[model samples]
Target: MTEMLQFDFMRIALVMAVLIGLTAPAVGTFVVQRRLSLLGDGVGHIALTGIGLGLLTGSSPVLGALVVAVLGAVAIEVLRARSRSGADVALALLFYGGLAGGVILTNAQGGGSSLQSYLFGSISSVSASDLYVVAALAVVVLGIVAVFGRELFLLCQDEEVARAAGLPVRFLSVLIAVTAAVTVVIAMRAIGLLLVSALMIVPVAAAQQVTRGFRSTMLLAMGAGVLSAVSGLAASFEYDLPPGPSIVLLALALFLAAAAGGTVVRRRRARRAGEVVPGPAGPGERPRVDAEAEVISG
Candidate 1:
């Protein structure tokens, strides 16, 4: 690690990774709670259009992506709130339209080759300016999370309940969407637009495997995200691999490990309680319903 950090680029990459690690999961906690796990991907797709626009206009791709992504996120939330039936259709349209626009714009600018880097990620290429932007955006994300964490949690747990409790549901919803958009843009350089959602989501899922409360899951998810990002960045450096995929794969591995461990712990608890632990469910059978209920109840 020390050897890797000796280079200026490596140091920048490391800082970017850590910042991304910390912020992605913070927003992801709410995303997962609302079961909108694919929201990041959708916003990322839109951000790609912004990137293409930046490249075509010879402007800053990050700034362009931020603008487009925030607008797209707000549009999505408004549409979702207004018409539940067409939400999926609206998202699909944005997803495909943004992707197509990005490809066309990028190719038009002869930036086709450069698009791959944004699509997958190239942490080594992260510049000092990019780091500054990422840091600023990350601070915004964390600040919003810190100040509105409980309200967001309530909003995610149940929108109806949140509304009944006199929370500003519409405003809070928009804020969450906008926050997620910023997070996607912040992570785009280090993690890539296509794979950024994995960083946002997988750690939270992994954390959920062992945690029972919202706060615990959020905290653990951030820890898991940081560990995955740092370790994956180091591994990629040592192995001459892609940093984005390596980080996402490591996060997935952690999820699998956590799932296995949680299962083992649950089974042991069940045994001590003299409950019968059933095996895998048969075809068309719902498995572990009783066991899950026991775990939840306990």
Candidate 2:
């Protein structure tokens, strides 16, 4: 523990944690809002294939990941346009195909470096160079989101409406796709490619379950993500476990906590309002069921 606090590598890892935690939720808010969460999973895995190709070519893994990540995003859009199965099926195909290709490439080279670390993650090994890349990527992602946030939100809420409002929805969609690719690439060093998508989606998913508005939800999700990243890294150090999976697990735990917390708050409010018992409906009233209870019962 003492070593972690004083060590430079640990500091870099922590910096990465903060950078990713902040921006991922911002991007993820759009992802979740648009119901495109699976894209994160697809792009992250595709990035692994890029890294494998990079290794084979002795190129920068970051660049390789970026190339494939963006390509995967574009491919998804294209596939969505051409197919009835839409984005989910496209995502599935890209994800598994990329993983299989990467594994084949790694195996062909006799598999010296275990790809599991890239799949699961190990933040303890983060270097200053990786931190630099992450910081740059975070800045770029945040900048794009900030400048075009309004349009992005409009598009996300209702693309046809955004188009009617003359918001250039197509351009914004492409911008988001590219930004997501870059974000995945930036995050790969800290969380690895396979599990990095969780960092993007889990916090936002949790926040949406509790928060009322888009802006508040995004902020809360970012906070949740940062907390998860830092605490998970700390726990990994203390337990001598893999950092990436630990961080993702921590984020998952936060999601569960937020859901439980939201439920408790709702019940408390209902009790305070003295609305626990149902009143008889008026003559015209049919029946109404609580959505939560229905989900639970089903």
Candidate 3:
């Protein structure tokens, strides 16, 4: 760790990784609660087209990605608000379309090069300018979440209730979507588009196993993500592996450990209480699934 810091680019990657690790999970907590986790992937796919265009034009791909990602978020919200198909369907359409367009454009302009770096990741690929752009965006994302914390929590709990209580669901929804887009762009630098959502999600999923408050989960997830980033980089440097995948693998291990630990704790608590405990939850299930259902029904 000390030796890697000697290089300027390594320092930049480390700083950017910490920023992305902290930021992704902060926003992801709300995203997971609202079941829009896949939105990250959809927006990333759309951002690819812009990244390709940027490469072709010899401009900053990150800027191109940010612009396209915001537009993708807008398109998603508009489609979602239209009552056309379900939210998942709308995201799926965008995901495929964006990927297809990105592939075509990139292939036409630049022989479809560097797709792997965009899809996977190369921490060394980030430059000082990339660091600045990501840092600025990270601040904006964190600020928005901080300022609208209450309203966003409400939106997570129930969009309709938030709307009924005059919380500006439409505006908040757009705000959150755009914020998520920014998160995706930042994450793309560390983990790449294909696995960026994992950074946003897996740590939060691990934190959820402990059953604290929503805010606690978010905090825990941030800690977990930072740990994963640092440790993953360490492992990659030691073993000559890819940084992003290594980080994601560590996060998965954490998630599994948390799930197993939570199961053991829950069973013990049930035994002490002299009540039969429910079976362990499936991978697909999340915390407050029943409450969210009630909110939906009501």
Candidate 4:
């Protein structure tokens, strides 16, 4: 790690990785609670169009992605809130349309080659200016999470209840969407738009395997995210691998390890209590770790 950090670019990449690590999972906790795992992917696709726009206009791609992504996120949340039956169809349209638009715009600007870095990531290519943009955006995301964390968690747990409790469900929902969009933009330079969602989600999922409450899950996920990001960046530098894939793969590995360890621990507890060990949770089943009882008790 010390050897890798000796260089200027590596130091910048390390900072970018840590920033991305901390911010992505912070918002991701609410996203997972809301069961919108794919929301990040959709926002990322739309952000690509913003990247293309920036390239075409000779402006900052990060700024362009932030604008477009936030707009798209609001639209998504509004549609999701208003049209339960057709939300999936609407999101599909946006996803494909954004991707197509980005491709056309990028090719028009003759930036097809340069787009690869944003799509797949090039951590070593991250510049000082890019680091500043990422840091600013990350702070914005973390600030939103810190301020709205409780309301956001309630909204995710049950939007109707949040509204009944006098919380602005609509506004908070849109806020989460916007926060997620900013996170995507922050991570794009180091992790790439295509895979940024994994960094947001995988750590949260892994943390869920061993945690018993929303707050604990969020904290553990952030730690796991940081570990994955820094370790994966180091590995990529050492082995000449791509940072994005390396980071994502490491998160996945952590998830698998956590899953196995959690299962063993749960079974041992069940045995001690003379209770039956439960089978694996179904897709629709929220794990016992995330049960409302657990969160409330905690």
Candidate 5:
């Protein structure tokens, strides 16, 4: 088992995992706060259309996917601008549209194998070239995230307030969406269209469970994502599981562990302060708060 870890395949997976770990949550933080977890799903599936087009034209699939994903993001913004309904409807339309386009194009061009890779992902088939592409995508993703960190936070906290404060909300929103599309494209290499959304959702969700502050949550989420990537890649190599699903499950396990630890700490502190109630929580029963009394008593 130890000897297996030193192989080139494992090494490539590790490098790819590191690149994915850093960018997934960085972009994911915004995606989560935007209430657009499905955005990744929508854009990722749409990316297949781009890959199909690329395969037909003998272009790079990654670049093609990136282009298609960005177009999808732009289309989303345009749709939101003109509509009164929620973004969910827009997402559904885009996803379905892209999926149909991809299927048709692939069938027409006789490139089912190439399209299959984009649709289902073939992480185990990753080559050194794929790693290089992912590394480049990581840099691009991180650059965009860093450049707009403040704007993203503003949007997340309160978009209306940000607009009132002259934060260019529309442009920022489009920028964030585009960044998410790019992240999804990069992650698709390892996780596939079916599961790439997990990379954006799991780590940040877990981090938010433990951290109240935004900075803390982002940092913790990034750490958790990196850990999951490393552990999951190792698991896939050792246990012959799929990489993307393994990473997601590892992340979920971490979340459960964190939740348990948080619960224990909160309860212990409450008990130590003699705040334990005599009976169990009732239906819609609120804890009787004696804030001033408790403070004085302490």
Candidate 6:
């Protein structure tokens, strides 16, 4: 820990991780709640083509990923709006196309020292300039979310109602999509393409297990993301584990613990409240009924 703090690269990696940890889950709560948990995955893959293009042109991969990810996210929203019923099909098509194109473009180009590193992340390789870009993007993404928090909550709760309430549902959704894409690109530096989606959704899921209110859940999820990334980075440095997967494992563990503990607490509360308490569901499952809510209602 001491040595890592002394090193600029480690410090940069930790800072980037913390920023992503906070930013990813903030948007991820809405993503998971809306059943769009895999949106980041598809966008991350699409961003790979951007990275390839950057490398081909001898530009920054981060720049490439940002532009491409944003465009891809916009395209997704456009396709969703156009197809309505076939949105999932369109997304799947985007995912595979992005992946295939990224590979062909990356290989056909002169190629970098290693594209695998980008796909899997190289947190320790972060530089000062990279850190600056990440910090700027993180601030912008978090700022957008902060400014429109209430609209986002309403939208997440139910699009129809949000629309009925004159909340500009389409605009809010597109805003979310663009923010989410920017978030994924930033996290891709620390978490990698394959695991970036997990960073976005898992911390939110863990927070959901522990918190009852949407507002609290959102805050807790961001906290969980930050803690997971920082602790995971420390552990990776101290124990010599790979950083990306290490951080993901820590977040997963938190989710499991939260799920089990929340279930036990709810079951006991239900029993005391004279409600029908069912057996705990599998890991990651939300209880069919909220025991505390039943108690309050009773």
lDDT against the true structure, per candidate, is: 0.91, 0.81, 0.86, 0.91, 0.81, 0.86
Best by TM-score: 4
Q: Estimate the TM-score of every prediction.
A: 0.90, 0.86, 0.87, 0.90, 0.84, 0.89
Judged by whole-model lDDT over C-alpha atoms, candidate 5 comes out at 0.81
User: In candidate 2, which residue pairs clash?
Assistant: none
lDDT of 3 by residue, 1-298 (tens): 8988888878898888899889999999999998888888789899988888777787888888898999999989888878755866767888888888777877877654478788888877788998989999999999998999899999999988898899988899999889999999998977888888899899999999976599999999999999898788778767878888999999999999999998988777667545323346465776655645464456
TM-score between model 4 and native: 0.90
**What lDDT does candidate 5 reach at residue 167?**
92
Q: List ranges where model 3 is wrong by over 4 Å.
A: 84-88, 271-298
RMSD of each: 7.1, 6.7, 8.0, 6.5, 6.2, 6.6
What are the per-residue Cα lDDT tens digits for candidate 6 across 2-25? 888998899889889889999999
Error of 2 at 105 (Å): 2.2
lDDT of 5 by residue, 1-298 (tens): 4765678877787888888888998889888988888888888878878877876788887788889989998888778666767766766878998989878887888877756656655556788998888898889989987888988998988899999999998889898888888888888877777778788888898888777578788888889989998888788777878777888899899889888877877677678657444345444545434443465467
Model 6 misplaced stretches (Cα beyond 4 Å): 272-298
Candidate 4 CA-lDDT value: 0.91
lDDT of 2 at 280: 62
Stretch of 10 with least lDDT, candidate 1: 275-284
Local accuracy of candidate 4 as per-residue lDDT tens digits, 228-250: 99999999999999899999999
